[model samples]
Target chain A: MKIARHLIAAAALAAAASPAFADASTEAFVEDNANEVLESLNDPSLSRDERTALFSRYMDEFADIEAVSRFVIGKYANRFTPEEFERFQAAFKKYALAVYENELDAYRGNEVIVEGSTDRTPRDSIVDTKIPRADGQEMSVRWRVLKRNDGYQVVDVALNVNGNLIWLAIEQQAQFLSLLDRTNGSVDALINRIERMTRDVVAGRR
Target chain B: MLCFGVTDRPPYVDIYLFIEVLALKAGQAAHICCLQHTEVIMKTVVSALIALTTLTACATTQDTTDTASGVSDPFEGFNRNVYAFNEAVDKAAIEPVARGYRAVVPEPARDGVHNVLTNIRQPVVFANSMLQGNAQASADTFGRFLINSTIGVAGIFDVASTLGVTEHNEDFGQTLGVWGVEPGPFLVLPLLGPSNFRDTFGIATDRALDPLTWTEFESDPDLDDHIAVGRTVLGLIDTRARLIEPIETLRSQPEPYIALRRNYSSQREAAIRNGETEADPYQDLPDFDVYDEESAEGTGAGDQ
Candidate 1:
């Protein structure tokens, strides 16, 4: 009887099948926007500030920054007051922008191809891509898109750096948590570190 | 009844058959007891066989995938031990020096060093490309080397790339693969992490082919030895420094060994394929999901 029940459950799971292909619109959406961002970065006429602003706007438009920010904070979310959370999010955006903005020039000559996508769950999908390098190598990038009430928003970006698939949000979580731990689990300490790091980046300090 | 315990030592199926035979010869009352015993034993035997068959099927599937991937690691036990040792060495010695090198060197200077090393490698690439009968790639590689050496300021700047002389990265292992040599058992050398038997052999051959190795030290043999040592040390440091971020990312994986193995094998296979679509070794492996329960929780707590 137990075996029969197990078989039935397995069959049910197999029946509620996910489509092999990712949602076409989502794939197109990511490819189009990623190209736009790359083009903006490559544009010689655009000033540094203008390019940064463009990147920021597009990033905010496509990326679920709030979801990422909350996710990074993890259980430490309770430690932050609403204002503190808002400040941290702002700081995070600046820090993330600073890091990515510095890397814009590196992406200038690369070609981005959206290979395909896989459904992670009912709500989430992963769009796979390959960025061919100048040195005759290829890098893989995956964008995690979550379906929201509005539309699909990118919650995370993962890079196959060398061979490792590194998720941006996960990396940030580690960094943020370490800072918090160092300050005796204080959220204020992490916020300060973020703000300081953002300031340093803005000032062109390493 | 004495036979029952003895038969239990054998497989349940054998015991069930034995009980059936006994039931045929025994009285009606004894036969009824045997019948009940056989029913219970039969169910157990059938379930056990089903489980055994399932396990065998799963094992066979795994073996098929491994075979299809063309990445056989017969010395997995030894390789894993070596891998662990290499990781320890990296953490203890190699990583600190690499980190220090990165901290001290300016970005452009580091790039210059990387460019120079890459330029030096072009001759090896050209030779291998020629060996593989890829004339166009060989020409391109030779052109890049010549242009970069002369106009690119000793290859400190990649001016050849601007002039449409793109890189053709070939190596002896790839050449061997092109010539239909099989990549034998996967290996992990002491410091050099993931490689295979064919690639390991290729490394030796490539070293022999290097111009630097053939340079005559007619006078000052000690200086030559020192120079050779310095070159190897610098190369090691440069490679390690470049890999710092990737290694850290790899270490963050739930199963670093498996992840690294998959990554290395796939990357090597891709290199061998050279932009040609081939069956991906990593295709059957589970997708890397960031929000997988264990990873999500672990990453959130900074525990992994």
Candidate 2:
């Protein structure tokens, strides 16, 4: 349910941004992306290693991480110079890839059926998808994606199964945003703090 | 029985099967005991079990906040194998795809696709800025960009940037921000970009009813359907291909998903509030002002 919403949101965000391709855009992108992705999925010759590599690319083409990053980074543009910003950009992309690569790797044969997109301004949409588990259990995962360009980015993923992970991300973002809102209306302090933590982790200080 | 569909994305599979077992067991016990409101309890449990199954797949770890409290970000425990998968694609898939599109499409057409996308987003952005009380002309500027994107250049170009049309990204999630909801963990969804729990919900609300179908789908997508779809999807692929190099930076941390969620979470808000720049609190900030160094040239591109 939650993951499904994420897919829907991605579609909605794409539709909202490119009103021109709203209804059928995903059908097109999916068919196109799936066509490319499914080729490898069908090749018995391919190993999971090969399949993972293949799907990752498909996912990249499917998602514009840099663009989405810029969209999400919205304001932090000013505090850093171009160089400093790029450093953060590097950090951001690495983190994004590290986070998502597994989920893509997890895509074996399970069909994630995308249902519909939502139509409301000022809100995110729910993308519906289903997971038919092997143990005679069927469930749903909705992807809550944000639309931008003619495509969408997954901003949050919800699992109707547990509802914990999706809720966890949202609840945390809200808390962090509040911190930013309260601190001179900027993310500087929080980012600064995170950077410090990151540095420590990288340096093995933490 | 919660007959589960076998799929590729899991950890969720194990969890879902487990819930199904729990529910079935509970139902059997309920039937034997003849508990009060058996049907209602069964439905509630079933619904919750079903709902819980979905929750486990939300691959995020934790949201950004002072570590005094908050769950650790899930990405902190990333599968290194997945990292390799991400890195490989950054090299193989996008390069060829980008090369293919660049060869076939005209630059103007490509830019037109880019522009049109930006234009439509201005209003949503304008609303975001207005909500934040961060900028003054946010709404009007958004409205102007909206018109230009929809009409000017036949809706081919995103005149917003040229005219300094800034967009803000406020949404139900940000509203929840106003209410101080926590952004759960950072999650990198397959096929979806990046997000967190709260924003995930925001994503759901954002797409509840697509306004585009009503507005854009009025006419037959028409005989040029394949061509039209190809052109646009290609335009989109071109856009995605463009980001591969930059997006790879997501792997720098153990918790890429959480990092991305934080960045995007903030980015969306900043866009909507039209974060005031030292140089232009009153004037709208240009799109991708800092990143697109090439476009940053005095194109003043922001002629408006």
Structural similarity to truth (TM-score) of each candidate = 0.50, 0.36
What's model 2's lDDT at A173? 36
Candidate 2, residues A1-206: lDDT per residue as tens digits? 99999999998787667523334444344444534554555457877667656756766666556653453343434445667667666665544443344333244345556655433222234455565533444455555445566665454444443222222233223333344444653445656644653453333210
- Candidate 2 DockQ, CA atoms: 0.03
lDDT of 2 at B137: 55
lDDT of 2 at B262: 41
- How far residue A40's Cα lies from its native spot in candidate 1, in Å, is 21
DockQ of each: 0.05, 0.03
Candidate 2 per-residue lDDT, tens place, B163-233, comes to 77553334545555555677675443322334445655554433322133124343655533443344345
For model 2 chain B, the run of ten residues with the poorest summed lDDT: B27-36
Model 2 scores a TM of: 0.36
Candidates' C-alpha lDDT: 0.59, 0.43
